[model samples]
Target chain A: MPRASLSPGAVVGLALRIVDEEGPDALTLSAVAGRAGVATPSLYKHVRGLAELRGLVSGRVLAELTEIAAEAVLGRSGDDALRALMDGWRSYAARHPHRYSVLVQAPLPETAEAGDRLVGVMLAALRAYGLEGSAAIHAVRCLRAVTHGFAVLEAEGAFRLAEDLDESYALLAHMVVSGLRTAREMSAADSTPGR
Target chain B: MPRASLSPGAVVGLALRIVDEEGPDALTLSAVAGRAGVATPSLYKHVRGLAELRGLVSGRVLAELTEIAAEAVLGRSGDDALRALMDGWRSYAARHPHRYSVLVQAPLPETAEAGDRLVGVMLAALRAYGLEGSAAIHAVRCLRAVTHGFAVLEAEGAFRLAEDLDESYALLAHMVVSGLRTAREMSAADSTPGR
Candidate 1:
């Protein structure tokens, strides 16, 4: 209980392991304290409370995802860039199902920067489609939903059939890209001077 | 303690209420027992245990979803049928956010009939696209992921932007249908007698 060197980073690292292994519900001050070899109250000096811990964890999770997206899309453009970013996203989700599972929840205030950066990467790749305003945003949501939805379903064993998931994922990327490819024309068509 | 007439149906009804009002995690035997005005042990006489209760709940959820999809797609075909089914899915998820949250998990054996019917409805809608075998299965997964992903994200407040979600959903349907309309060609292309 006397480990004075336990910084917030150390606390977050332990908490991440807890989240990665047992899921978000298992995270608690007592749980982290037990892992950190300290009393639950003693840990308050390092982090504010459970919410703060979760925020820190969220920040880390989003930041990591942003990095993966950036790396995957680097030197790529158009469908290739978008596909790479999505592939990185699903791979991250698959590797860390527990962490990936929490992503559906809105990021906390502390994690907004990381969250925005992640969105920025997605937007950068989506730039290839020339969609603007609402169309671009909708495309973002569609891509996110596809990857997030597919990854979560696969992790939960929802796809019970014997079909190859990898193949399905590739097909999804193709479909979404096709959808993105049309957003511009759809927008332009909507903007035309017609009744 | 002499309520020997309490049927399994009664227990499931109570469990469904708990899940609807609370969530999947809140469906413990003790909680259901509290709602049923009986001891946890007495409730066990009707339902086997927590797992069985979950299975029963899953069956109810899937059955209800199957019914919605069937009604939505009735007398419709191709994109209309597909849109109705997807709209039905997202609306059902929005209405029963708590119950919908658990659909990602594998359906317990008891829920297989309901689950299969749900898949059947989806397949029926997709029949107009003329996709079969792996291509058909992949298309199904794509649709499932879009609705599931969008619903879950929306429920969790993940879509923080100011864009209209309804419009985004419509766009998603359009994009996915466009992708599906080509699945037949994509499949045929794969089977062509070329190296």
Candidate 2:
């Protein structure tokens, strides 16, 4: 077989395709090269090794997710922004289950800039609730927990009841917004004079 | 070499050890047999095959988790029960990371009695908040999402900030309780007559 022309971007794309179709466990250098119609030795010219290839794919996926999330909450705030962000997360996971799994487990960049950017957008949205610093961080973590956990279970078909998922997801979003508001209220009460 | 005296229980014990020490990927019949001082063929006398072994391990892990969670919520209700349940989940995951992962991904029993038993305990806890039917199910999913997501991320060192985890967990517990209260209030409002 002729060695196909492959760039680093093309290599990452092929790797992503492989992971999406066959799951992360099925990803290997030889398999990727085979799928790309390139020799195993020639593939190394694009990506340093399997680890680098995975990292590139992870970075790309995170970048894309962050972009989508940013756009979702662009003109929204408070509960509306929260709903948009949550919807964005669930939709991304639903549309790309394997890639989402990879994103969760993949070795993100050492700087984690892409992740931080996504979190920054979340913080901006939560600002409408008067959260900042540690409070904001905690709320962000809670939001992430709800979104990631629900998405994983949903993808795995763990919610086996006949209930509509949209209703369930909406309830979850409402719960998070309510939680954030309560956190803000409690924080306010703590700083107030006298009971 | 004489074949070791290996019962099914002992085989499962050894498999659990392997998974705890080297992760699930390292778990195999040959590896378990080697560790158990039995030939690979002799291992079949105890477990039918790899699939059965994994199933046994998964069953055992789920059973242990369910028991732990049940005990934690016993003699508790409302926010207290919720806090205990969340702590129970986080503690179990911390104490046995590998087992927790298996529980999440394992092909749980089709009947899922053990899982149902665990959910039953969660439902009992949620009942204190006047939740039932789909409401209870949604609340339970929310609880599971927070606990599972936090535990998974914590185990992976995903939260790199310097903040104390105990504080963060407390905040999360407060958030969940608040969310439940708000959800209950919303449901109540929806049922009430003219504003």
Candidate 3:
């Protein structure tokens, strides 16, 4: 693991590993360098500092999440797509709780391109329900709020009940799908002629 | 401000103020003591240390949130109670973003009476929908996830679009109410004799 052998992507990959294994609090330049078998200074050659390293990690994770979500919803739409997307998100968070925590805590990249791409996938899924612009954004935010919130709470072991989480999650997904449909119907009713 | 005069409640209150003003990261025991005009070591008489102080703060805040939510839904039922409870939660989070952050980050106390009370308030509100048992827990979890997630994301400036957030929130509330009704209807249908 010579400095010449270490690329920016390699450094970030190691940093992601650190976060995944030891939690976000353990992700420091020294820790990453130690794990990667490179000098701390050599790590700086790839990332300016911890802030930039965190940004890179966040961006990378967001992109990966976007890809997973996109693949889940491929050739699917409406409730099917929503369920697939949400289940994918929950699975990703469960598998990499620390990395997911980083995504929630770290600010999106300055350009926000990665975030936008993630949102784009969501908007595309919402298209099945004929929502766009602000309506779709509202629905997307609602969906994100519930799924992200549930995943974070679950990671924190906040749900103390004895019931199976998978069953609980299914029920949550049902509510979201039902809720989106209801919102669409309301919007349609508001646009129609008076009775 | 003297150690002899400082009560545990007073120390916890001052700690809350520190969290509210400067974010949870700044909530050191020394910071709380300095703000209260007491010596750091003397503050320990009131709180064991940072961990206990955080637990006390979390328990206190959760109790406060439960009170606010309970009051909001008093004499209300169904959609009215749901709307009031969610709005109350949103407002509390908005007014004290850092404190809300601590609520999310800090682990609930071992006794968890405060946390259970909060859930009790949620269940009472859902009673209007004729939901009980696991269904009610699932619904309560759904409500918590969406409202908590929305508040956290909003505090992080994740909602960057120009749309009126109040309007979006209103739409979300509408969706949740409608969804709950729909779920109720579906549950009733499944239990009926007809196909």
Candidate 4:
């Protein structure tokens, strides 16, 4: 039996590359084995099955996203942190569109702790902007909706506009920033207005 | 020849039913034909192929969504209209999660006139709130993102809240209405905000 230098991480990484190059439908266990220069059984030895492999890829992608998001918010606060983190998110989506989709759809319980950590990072970042409780939760969800929708649409070429999409995204980021600012102000005013 | 009463629309409708009951991964041409009480070849007589069948399902879903959205905005204006329409969007999503997802991810033609019609319908609804041009476009996109994201996450059980999701959804709609109003007011003042 010939031993391959490839690890499970390498196999999953190559699988992601295949997905990125050929779309998710093109991802097959045999194909991943071939790409990773391993026997099909050898591939399964490390990963459980296609679903498990997909889960691994999803977890890795989510962890990467969480790290990038955390880095983006580090040393930044308020609206600036939100912008930075959101930009990090958009950039991650842009750079890894297929993997991003995988992350979006794949349910990785293993990544739940990591995802929660990422959310904590987001909540902390928004805390600088003064949104807490339901407002904070609402802000995070709204941002996720806006960012996920835009990224997925962009990936699918849904922006059939004559104008550049980048411009629209920039404007979107601005509006989101301003909206968060308003929400923060309102949150403060709830305590004491006209001070 | 054994003939069944299944038509193309019935086939697609049954396929949507299968999707709703068993999920997209469970949807297959054979399964659709089986559910429609027809032969596979007879099913093909009504549709082009699997992709076409999926496209038909997506088209019907989008058409229904357009009608519901139009109805939600009727005789309503401003925040009232926005909330009603967005609520309608969410209801559509919740009721038809599988088809809604297919609608989001399916590839439409670059010059897909159907999508244009859908967008036009949404824009008309926004116009009830006095939005025009790119603001109208942006509002539609934002609304779509929020609706799609929330629906997707909701269907996927992404939210881990102890409270009722309907409560969160109401808050979501309220927040979107607020944001849209702010965007409308700000865009109006800018006088030359570009898409």
Candidate 5:
């Protein structure tokens, strides 16, 4: 809150707080500067600009998610690892809905490494399926789609039925694991001669 | 574009055009009013406000998509129907990236019936899968997640690999259909006598 104490990290932290609490529309340079007890132009001394500040927020969110995912999938493999990863992410999204949306805009050019780290954990969970090359990439895409899409839809109140959302999510994870196993089988079948 | 010619439909059409061309940020009552050759205050007679205008856009988008999906899956069943539905949506999202996002915010309160019509087409596509009740709901959710997630991520430039995105989408469709069949088999197994 003091002038001398407002560093770049402090400015980003405040900006993130604003987005997390008041929503993204409130995340302007002026608001961040005001919250930091500095004039609007003075923010130039802290963050490079509003764009960079937003990127920093995305990077931080990605880094945090990567950490959570890495921990959740550690020492696990196959379906066990995949389910853990999805559950862990579902929890993160539920706890910080706004920040979770920020994370979705992740892997910004500046935060590419953080994005890859998160993606790596997901890819690792699929390693046991033994898909390689293009199949491997598509598997990752499929995993992300199921998890992220479900989260976004749920957040948008799209699952209006009284049926337990947890149940639906659990079933979703089950179906995806089944699908991956089937893909592995299909790939194997394709490579086999005279099946 | 004259004031006498401008109606609620005209305002929403202009608003959707703005979102489709210039992105969501450019969509405002003033922008729509200007495009309609009417003052911003005149929008009150055509639509309740910005929110209602936006909701109309979503409704129109949903109606359009529902028609496409209905046509794609007609006379098809099982995996064929599912793939048709997804491919139809992918084509829509590809052609109207911005309006596609608007469709995602859809099924807004004012657009509930339109949303249900769109959803019904999808549910009908899944009819051959034979899942009912909660499983039915979850199946729809899964289908939606895979399709919507894949679209959103692709649009966001998240799938940066050199691999063919179309192929990946095809594989995704295959995987989801396989997953649904598995769910059906599992449910059947549960209902049957001791194995």
Candidate 6:
């Protein structure tokens, strides 16, 4: 009965710990209850089910990502801001590989409010670089895809080369910055009349 | 018992069908056995187990991706080849969203022959544009990350924007091409020094 005292936050926190120690497959409502020393029904008092529990974890992860991205963009502008934000994301992912995977796993519309906050952070980081309108959105999507894809693969240990992955990541960051600058120039030129 | 006549390829094919219809979570040894019209033990004759079966499926997906990238790059070079290869990958992802996730999920060893083949395809595509050595490797990785990340998020319905994702994808492709070009140039310039 004392197990009923466990709060939703405690349950979710325990779920994350399990995931950190055992990977995503190890996460389940029953497992979380057991870890929390509570019955599955007791967990229902705070969380909906496994799906909701996972969603809760996802919300936390996204929020954390937003914080990190926002911090990375603080007092920085242009390419420097972009790099700092992206590097911050990469650092978070490297540190909490499993939790980050949850963020990437499925798109949670239920957590849209939290997710949007993260998106706002990401967009604001890009804004410091002067990208706006469709170009800004496009740049954000492109930047996200590249950063996340690289992070996921790296987490999965997909890189085969004996070379330092850090080296590759630095190159990736440089490429994204250069890519944004080039896209900015190209779009600018496209909008202008022929020389 | 008569289903004992099925080959590993047939079993894998049927398993892929289940993945297509129901996604990976629906995949189980019992389910595969039932779907294939064989007793679960009979499945052992063709595949090792659930993990092995999944591995087979994952390998098939990776090989298919390699083939598609190859087809896209054939007779193409530079931005054209890059776009073609990425478009080919996107088309495949769209057609086989579930399998695409599977390919990205299972991490393969870099030293493995299959891993080499996958990288070989992408690198060959890059070589068409004069991207060589680490620069070529970095370009291949950048292209892969953006294309893959975009496709997965698209598949997961991550975007809530009003605009068509196709337009977003097109822009993403443009960004990747421009990014790769810029990265290659920077690498070349960095290596050249005295310029």
Ranking of all predicted structures according to lDDT, beginning with the best and ending with the worst: 3, 1, 5, 2, 6, 4
Per-residue error for B19 in candidate 1, Å, reads: 3.6
Q: In model 2, where do residues sit more than 4 Å from their true spots? A: A1-3, A108-113, A184-195, B1-3, B108-113, B185-195
**lDDT tens digits by residue: candidate 3, B122-174:** 99999978986788887888787778888887776687788878867777787
Query: How big an interface RMSD has model 2?
Result: 1.8
Index of the highest-lDDT prediction: 3
Task: Judging by DockQ, tell me the better candidate of 2 and 3.
Answer: 3
Candidate 1's iRMSD: 1.9
Kindly report which residue pairs in candidate 3 clash with one another. Answer: none
DockQ of each: 0.55, 0.51, 0.52, 0.38, 0.54, 0.52
Error of 5 at B78 (Å): 1.4
Candidate 4: global Cα-lDDT? 0.73
Candidate 6 stretches with Cα past 4 Å from truth are A184-195, B107-113, B184-195
The predicted structure with the larger DockQ, 2 or 6, is 6
Model 6 lDDT per residue over B60-175, tens place: 87788888888888998877788788788888888988877777666454225666687888888777567657767766677667777888877666777766666567667766
Q: Rank the candidates by DockQ, best first.
A: 1, 5, 3, 6, 2, 4
C-alpha lDDT (0 to 100) for residue B113 of candidate 6: 63
Q: What share of the true interface contacts does candidate 2 keep?
A: 0.42
Kindly give the stretch of ten consecutive residues in candidate 6 chain A with the minimal lDDT sum.
A181-190
lDDT of 4 by residue, A113-159 (tens): 76787778778877866655676787777676767777777666677
For candidate 5 chain B, the 10 contiguous residues with the lowest summed lDDT are: B99-108
Candidate 4 clashing pairs, residues 3+ apart or interchain: none
How large is the interface RMSD of candidate 5?
1.9
Pitting candidate 3 against candidate 5, the one with the higher TM-score is: 3
* Model 5 agreement with the true structure over A103-171: per-residue lDDT tens digits: 555434877777777778888888988988888888888888888888877766676778888877876
lDDT tens per residue, model 1, B128-158:
8888787788888888888889988776567
On TM-score, who's better, 3 or 4? 3
Per-residue lDDT for B172 in model 4?
Answer: 60
